[model samples]
Target: MKEIRALAFDVFGTVVDWRASIIREGESLGRRKGLSVNWAAFADAWRAGYQPSMERVRRGEIPWTNLDGLHRALLEELLEKFGIEGLDEAEKDHLNKVWHRLAPWPDVPEGLARLRERYVLATLSNGNVSLLVEMAKRASLPWDLILSAELVRRYKPDPEVYLMAPRLLDLEPQEVMMVAAHPDDLRAAAEVGLATALVRRPLEFGPGRSFRIPESGFDLVAGDFVELAQRLLGREATAGPRRRGAPRPPSPG
Candidate 1:
């Protein structure tokens, strides 16, 4: 654990509440346009296109496209599908940048402030670099640097993306811990020798969606980022060491 010199974070749902941010912005747009829509569903629908859009790039079906571009394309499709209209090019463009203004989870700024005192902190998200930079500024997030899929031209769950962070920091993979709300992200990082920490966000999808907490295999699991900071900084104690093995599906929350 002492060898860990840096923490690479998964930003979207891990740090910022993308669902809430997008829904808020979407609802604002709907009100202005006098269009009634399920803003939550719209937010979900926009996010739904995220993975599949990235998959195209991952599979070589399309050339490299940053998250910003992919998000715009997805938003356009969602608007048409949701039957939303009257948004002009400028309005569409402004709405597309909603991702840039995502608010961090309540614990993020304080937690990251504490964590930054101990180690270098940076974003390890699929979001493009510019988007992340804007988000950090808008949300007052304190990141030492911005490292994203755009920097390496590869999305996460890819070994190359996980490997890129350590290389950029001039450290071994084990010297950097990947902090995220998603187990799949942590598992992928762990597979490549980076330490893994899970920060559970039960309502990440929405109020009713089921999100299982990891039963084992991760290096640390905490209820939120502040707890994560406490565990990482040795301020609070966790249950104990976890046995490394396959992750058990979490029971219903």
Candidate 2:
């Protein structure tokens, strides 16, 4: 992993806690509608539709589309299933945008800010570029570039998406570190010669939400983004003697 330079992160559960933030947003919106809905259940069920929804497109059962497009379709189905009605098109549109408004995991911004000082940080998310860009602005995420599956038209766990980043950044796969909360994503990255870093977010799915990160062939493991930055610095700092206060090396592009 010595040649690793750019650190590309998976955005949803990895950088921001999507499930919990969605629940909070749903609860607030439900309260306004006086709908006494189980917001947590609503959030989970909506997200549960996520994978099957994408597979439809991947299998060519439907047309190719961005995550936001896919999400809006699932959101409409869920609204009807949950008996959530009486919303105007405008309100529904706003609700669809909720994914764009998700707050970061508590440590994310501060940690990324610190890490950005030394590395060229880019988002390598399944989320669409526009969606990721909006989320970055909404949450004040300090991403140097937004590199999404939308650009590659492929999703996580696909070698295309994993390999696209290094090409876009003009580097070898080994010079790019794939940072994700999901072991499956990093596993895909590793299969293609990329370095891997796992940053745990045990509560990413919320307290009772059932997602787990299996131990895997990761190059590094971190408690959170802050720890990730600290460990990277430690690795670089120990690489060799350097002129005092000299700049650290940068990743390609």
Candidate 3:
């Protein structure tokens, strides 16, 4: 409601289906390597390591390392934990870069396009610059820019990470909305005076996993990116009675 000029999104679960993408890629790797493994569990374990790995950095238990480095470290552990073997260095590297090739949620491409008509869209994620860039290119994500925690050498839930968006985009915190599927991420943005929008991603952790929607504490809540665009643009359209030449929100696709 504060006239948002830009939208900064959490890429992993909000825009792209990371779990499914990882599982798909892992299955492919398993086949090529002739390894029998539960890829779903493997994907979950890899993702499970994400926060703890970041926390290690936050606690200064490790020196500054990008998400790629953290993920590669986790991948090595997971390979051994799951009894996987015989992958050459190149194969392992390709599997590690699977994060770069994640498929976007079905609504993302057009939804972001719709939102971009009025708002500058950027990725505000924990992923490294190269990783985010490759993902945007591979998925045709249509981001106006990629702003990562790697730029500031920090991870999400860190105030500096959220603050980076407003600083880099030359906008007030309120003028940039942080769009994420996770409440903690949005809450952190809100604490830093940025507007927040929660886009529910019930399947982010995969099917049958219980996801609780917050009852309040966000500027907006949407089921997906398309709905987010509709809500934001719709509000703008009706803000003060449309002028004769004013643009209307795109009809639902």
**In lDDT terms, which candidate is top?**
3
Model 1 local distance difference test score: 0.87
Reference-based TM-score of each model = 0.91, 0.92, 0.94
TM-score of 3: 0.94
lDDT of 1 by residue, 86-159 (tens): 98999999999999999988988889998998789989999998899999998898899999988779998999
lDDT values of the candidates?
A: 0.87, 0.85, 0.90
Number of the predicted model whose TM-score against the real structure is largest: 3
- In model 1, what is the error at residue 22, expressed in angstroms? 1.0
> Alpha-carbon error at 154 in model 3, in Å?
1.1
lDDT preference between candidates 1 and 3, better one:
3
Compose the digit string of candidate 2's lDDT tens values, residues 50-149. 7888788788899889998999999889888889988999989889988899889999988999888877899998899889999999899989999998
Can you write out model 3's per-residue Cα lDDT over 147-233, one digit (the tens) per residue? Answer: 999999989889999988888877778888999998999999999889999998889988899578784899998888889999999
State the displacement of the C-alpha of residue 12, model 1, in Å, after optimal TM-score superposition: 0.7
- Point out where model 2 deviates above 4 Å: 208-212, 241-253
